[model samples]
Target: MKLIVTCLFSVIMVYSTIAQNVAISDDGTYTADNSAMLDVKSTSKGLLIPRLNSFEKDNIPLPAHGLLIYQTDGEEGFYYNNGTPSAPEWITFTDESNALWRKDPNKNVTYLSGNSDSIGIGTDSPSARLSTDGMIEAMSDGYKFPDGSVQATAVFPANFSGYESAADRRWVIAMCADEIPGSWEYQGFEECSKVIDLEWGIYVPYEPGGGGVTGNRVHKPITVIKNIDKATVRYIQELVEGQGINEIEFHFFWINPDTQQKQVYYVITIGDVKVIDFNHDVTHVGNEIFSHVDIISFAYEIIHWNWLPDGIEFQDNAIGP
Candidate 1:
């Protein structure tokens, strides 16, 4: 009885060891446990395999469509297509009209679009998917200006007095006296002492009365002196005949005292008469004559005769005297 019991006990121990080395599911099929299995092949009864976690080719069951499964607790789950599983946290589906679907924080989706096959993470287009390093690639294409051009206008400061007519009032002068050599000298005069007279006057407009005496002064024609750095004369010459510049004219006007009639005279100052080809050019000449007349002194005077009443007042009506 002792010998039979010893043999039975030995056999029981061996069976127990084998049972500990293998794993059995509820289906009655066995698989290798955590140990004692390496490079074993599958059989009809079971698979003599390594541990399920250690086996490189183990068939992992994928989750159903639209379903998610997790490998470890607290980790995001992945989706499955057919029997094949994807990386953890893979996208399954997203709402088409939702902007949050396009701006997902985790960035799990691969392709993105408004369709069902697309999974948006940060953008509505498929090209906006995140790179491998979890960085969102910029998909903004450069844009051009709408009309392909830029426009600007030249502006001058308000304090600039170069174009103001009121600032030119100081140029008007009646007469300037200058001392000259004198032929005869006093008793104590030095040798070669002489005296002469020099006078300069500016042209000014005056109304002629019935007595021939001018009255009711109107416009003043004064010589404008400009000290334009080193290129003063050269600059003035260029402006006189440059592109788009036609003939320049100096205008003189006289108004009658009694009838207030006015008469105007024009003299060609620079450029040719043929240069006035267009009406626009003529208008430009008018502007230039009003603004840019500088240098060169002119002389004029008025002769008066008492033919009308001294205190008479007249209303302006006539076109010319």
Candidate 2:
């Protein structure tokens, strides 16, 4: 039975109004400094603050601001109430990351990294930065993807990042009899009747090479073109002279959808890197044929329509912008 009189939880105290000083001690010595209203000292034992397990700690009724305790539950450590009576919050100290992570009495991951400066979610080895193995959500603000983008204005969320843009582009439709790469024929070609029965119409990027250096070199060339029939592709992407609008690039990753091979590509969406080129070949079944059709059709369309005015030019070059 511990007996304390003056203060509810005090151990021992001595006062000398004549000396104009007060002192409290557990080892029978007045070691408190003269300028203190309260001083506690123990030589053989340590002072105990409010200590409770996770559940017990959470049940504090109307805990005042700054209420602190040492929790002995799931995320065992010291915790503090972030000031709320209805739904008091308990912030925990994690030893693994050696930081204080915010905890809502009922939730696990309140904040990423548990307060660590560098945080990685899916992977244990987080970059000396930040990484999430999933999509991030923002209310309605603009965004900056991992690849790269060309914005119509100086804002973000990329007004145009190879997703959709019709400001300065032409349209063409081509179709092929089968999935065979050699059977693709543009809807409109000159000098002869169409031999390939490839009927495909989709806006393809003919505009590339405007933004300055992207550190991506012109990959190895693919050159094999026959009159109206293209077996290969090459050449200069249109270079916008001034303003921020420059080149547009389409990155291709060969993948076969018929066979469920590696799911790496499907797990994530692409749109924010720094370069574009022929990289990665994932086989499922008929991906190569479809890719061939796209390459040939768009290649010729770009050839016939690139750099031409928005509409047809009449005699004497009288036209509209």
Candidate 3:
């Protein structure tokens, strides 16, 4: 019995030494001896068992897997599942290649390309071209009349003929013009009294060339009466007494029938009266004496000329010799 107990204690010591000798290699594979206990100093390799007393099935192939790792000086090292043997820095699936790629558990994939210093994903191709010359030409090519020109002419109404006559219904003719200051002269009429028996006369307001140059001129005629009676004179006086009469002075331009030079006719009417101021005393006049005097009515007429041409050019000032 003493010899059997000593043999059991020696077996227990050997088993304890084998269990503590188990080790793993640098390639992540484990190795051990076939004994139920692992061997520490045994140089020979064999099937790896994960732990002491763990079960092992013989002749079964070991499962194999791979990992890709990257190393840079300043960046942390990481691993990818799809890296190829040729370009371990880039990873690819069956369809596309990616560098520094990752996919989350939700299946979203991201990748980086270009210099490792900068990175981009989901970007492709480049941008489309504008004309600077056409704009400059349009701005360069973009209408450029004199002073004191006139546009239209002046006209008078069509129905105007002349003023009504005072004597025998015959129309009186007259014309008006601006007189030069010293050039206006009057002949064959009393001062302020324009009545005259002559065929023609002139009224010039200045001493022949004083006031200014004439702008417009018109022609008109006067009505005349041959014989009148005293009763008619009295009746005419009754018609015109106390009524205001217009004092019209005339400047007439008459063409000589032979010489053809223009001669001016002037006349003035002071008080075109219906009543005669007889010098004879009204109380002393016998009925027979009053029978001889006669009354006459007279008026001036205006004649218009249409011969003046439109757009006539004239000197700014009248020419004087």
Candidate 4:
């Protein structure tokens, strides 16, 4: 009993002596730095801070100001709460500045300045009253301008004519189509045909001859005539009759230049008449046809009656300005 009491008394004295400063080091004799509450010194090791994910770090209850922790996810770095416990503002110690925008308690809104300064959302530098690198969406509210004018949801004009000054509407459509991939391909092109269909429009770039030692090739658009039908199936039938071949099997792939969608074409020439017949029944099969003539007819109806085409998947409905 006496030995037990003596050991407890010794432990208390050692703790009391080290209460002012605590030093952890390889060598037991090293003293702690006077400024730091707990000093850890090592030559071959590093001081590891508490690591937590964004969810765990944010859920810390009443975290004190100046509390530091290493976050593992969502802009991972060391974070310290600069604000008080009741209104903690945890900011990254890694490259975070005092002028950095502060997210509100709801976390939905972020504010860089309270007043007397320009505000920026997606950009750090602001050249105007409000500058953003991304789109600004106003949900269930109208926008008010500096001129004291309020604007609600804008609707397109009833008689709106697009690009009144432009000479060609197709050129404008092509320009708009260039911004997005898979807008359209050559019309009446087969989805599985191996040959390149010239009907779909293929732009081949070539260098023009000029008065120079070496000709530098420059790309330029060339006008092409769509006259493949003039090749005359009658001429092909005459040649086939001379050879006495009753049936000639031929398949061609066609791509819609406007939609970039491929359509399959299978043709069989019989006798000297060169009569055309589709493998699938015209009326038996569904509206979706892989034949060239059928697709052209379908496109005509789509443009004439403003009907929707099949196999079109929609994404975010945004038009470029």
Per-prediction count of colliding residue pairs?
A: 14, 19, 31, 20
lDDT of 4 at 194: 19
Please list the Cα RMSD from the true structure of every candidate, rounded to 1 decimal place. 28.8, 19.3, 43.2, 23.3
| Tens-digit lDDT track of model 4 for 199-235 | 2212334445754444332212111111112222332
Candidate 3 lDDT score at position 318: 12
Q: What lDDT is reached at residue 44 by model 1?
A: 38
Better of 3 and 4 by lDDT: 4
The C-alpha local distance difference test score for the whole of candidate 2 amounts to 0.36
Which run of 10 residues does model 1 get worst, by summed lDDT? 168-177
Give candidate 4 misplaced runs (Cα > 4 Å).
1-19, 97-321
Q: Candidate 3 versus the native: TM-score?
A: 0.15
Off by over 4 Å in 3: 1-204, 209-226, 238-321
What TM-score does structure 1 among the candidates reach? 0.15
Local error of candidate 3 at residue 312 (angstroms): 23
Question: What are the models' TM-scores?
Answer: 0.15, 0.28, 0.15, 0.27
Better of 1 and 4 by TM-score: 4
- Please report the TM-score between candidate 2 and the true structure: 0.28
* lDDT of predicted model 4: 0.40
lDDT of 2 by residue, 1-321 (tens): 345444644435444232445555565556556776556665666657777988798788988777889987688778888768777877765443454455455765565444446667676776546655543445774454463222111111223222122333212212221111322232122111111122223232344677554442221212211213231222112112112112212211111222212111111111111122222223325432122222222211111112122443222111111
